[model samples]
Target: MTALAAEAVRHDRELVARHAYGDPEAFDEVYARFSGLVFQIARRMSGDDALAEDLSQEIFLRIFRHLRGYQGRSSLKTWVYRVAINCCRSRLARRSRRERAFVAVEEGRLERVPSAAEGPQGRLRRREAAETVGRALNRLPLAFREAVVLRDVCGLSYEEIATVAGVRLGTVRSRIARGRDRLRLELERGSS
Candidate 1:
């Protein structure tokens, strides 16, 4: 690691230690630093604003409860990411099962009528494009989705993703490639 990178890892270790030792502000600092990241990951993985908010709360609670047990093997960021991803995956599994048993009333949505405030066609096109991509992302398999989200959305390096996912570095690269290819295909199919 470069000197600056090493220093960052060391700082994260110290932060975890401080939190474990009951430094009252340590966790608040952590929350301030990572809350946005956690929410972004939750929002992308779950594809719902309200569910993302709830998942973010659960992730913070888990971090608080398990902070003392943190091993300091990885940076605190990677550890928190793994925790968040695991929680979201588990919750999604439960939700999938429950949803399979019932038909959702909100499954179909009405088309929006352009109002005076939505004046520009370009802006409306961008919104539609983003929604299409979001739907394609939601269709990805769990492993691919996680890999893509960590790398593409959360912007983690391949090495960091390997560490977080407990997989080999090559596996991370391969998953990312395949995930991206699948995502592109999904997007193309949607456009068709």
Candidate 2:
């Protein structure tokens, strides 16, 4: 790791140690650092604003409750993401595939307020593109979807994804490749 990265890992360890020791401000610091990342991952993975909000809360609750067991085996960011992804996967697994599909379909119907700068046509185009991507992601197998979303949406390194997903590095690469291929096919089918 670079000097900066090593510093970050050390800092993460100290923060976790503080939180585990009941430092009043440590958890708040943790929340301030990770809340946006957690929420964005939830939103992109779940594709529903309201559900994302709920998942964000649940993720933090899990983080708050389980903060003590964190051994600092990985970067705190990686550990937190692992927890967030696992939580999302569990919630999604409980719903029937048909239910997930229905929700994904319904997601496209929700409206958003457009930026004044974008104008109506720009807003329409942006919405359509987002729907297309979301639909394609939803159609992907869980493993592939998780890998692709982690890599593309969450911007994690390949090694980081392998750690978070508990898979081999090769497995992560294969999943991302296959997932992108499937996503490309889906988008092409949609466009044509």
Candidate 3:
């Protein structure tokens, strides 16, 4: 790690320790630092804003509840991400508990509405495109899906993805690449 990266990790470790000790300010700072990332992960992975909000709340609750058990083996960011992804996985499993009797599905929603500029046909085209891409993403394997979402949707670095996924850097790279390739195949198959 660079000097600044090392310092930030050290600072985050302290913050996590302080929170474990019931320091309210430390908890607040940690929340402030990571809530956005947590929320975005939940939101993107779950595909429902309302559900994402609830998932975000659950992620924070789990974080606070398990603060004392944190060993700092990974950075606070990585730990938090692990929790967020697990929560999302659970929520998704429960939500789609049928055909997917026992599997993880992080099917994200395309919740964008084209502006007034899109008119009618354009809006239809946009919706179809979003659904097509969303389905392709959803078809990825769980490992690939999580890696791609963290790297592409959450904008996390490959190193961060590796830490969060508890995998090696090369694994992260392979997962993302394979996920994109699978997504491309799915989309092409759908369009045909």
The sequence of per-residue lDDT tens digits that candidate 2 reaches over residues 1-192 is 889888988898888889888997999999999999999888878777898999999999999988888886777899999999999999877753548667666544433333335765987777767766775676677789899999998899999999999999999999999999987766665555
In candidate 3, what are the lDDT values of residues 1-192, reduced to their tens digit? 678868877888788788877789998887899989998888767656898899999999998898777786777788899998888777777675563633333333323333335666877777766665654565555678888899888888999888787889999999999998987665555545
Q: Write the per-residue lDDT of candidate 1 for residues 1-192, one digit (tens) a residue.
A: 779878988898788889989998999999999999999999998888999999999999999989888876777888999999988989887876676433244333323323335556867766776666676676666788889999988889998888888889998898899999986765655444
| TM-score per model over all chains | 0.81, 0.82, 0.73
lDDT of 1: 0.81
Regions more than 4 Å wrong, model 3 = 99-136, 190-192
Of 1 and 2, the candidate ranking higher by TM-score = 2
Stretches of model 2 off by over 4 angstroms after superposition: 97-128
Best by TM-score: 2
Q: Residue 103 of candidate 2: its Cα lDDT?
A: 63
> Which is the better candidate, 1 or 3, if ranked by lDDT?
1
**lDDT computed for candidate 3:** 0.77
Score candidate 2 by lDDT: 0.83
C-alpha lDDT of all candidate models, in order: 0.81, 0.83, 0.77
- On lDDT, who's better, 2 or 3? 2
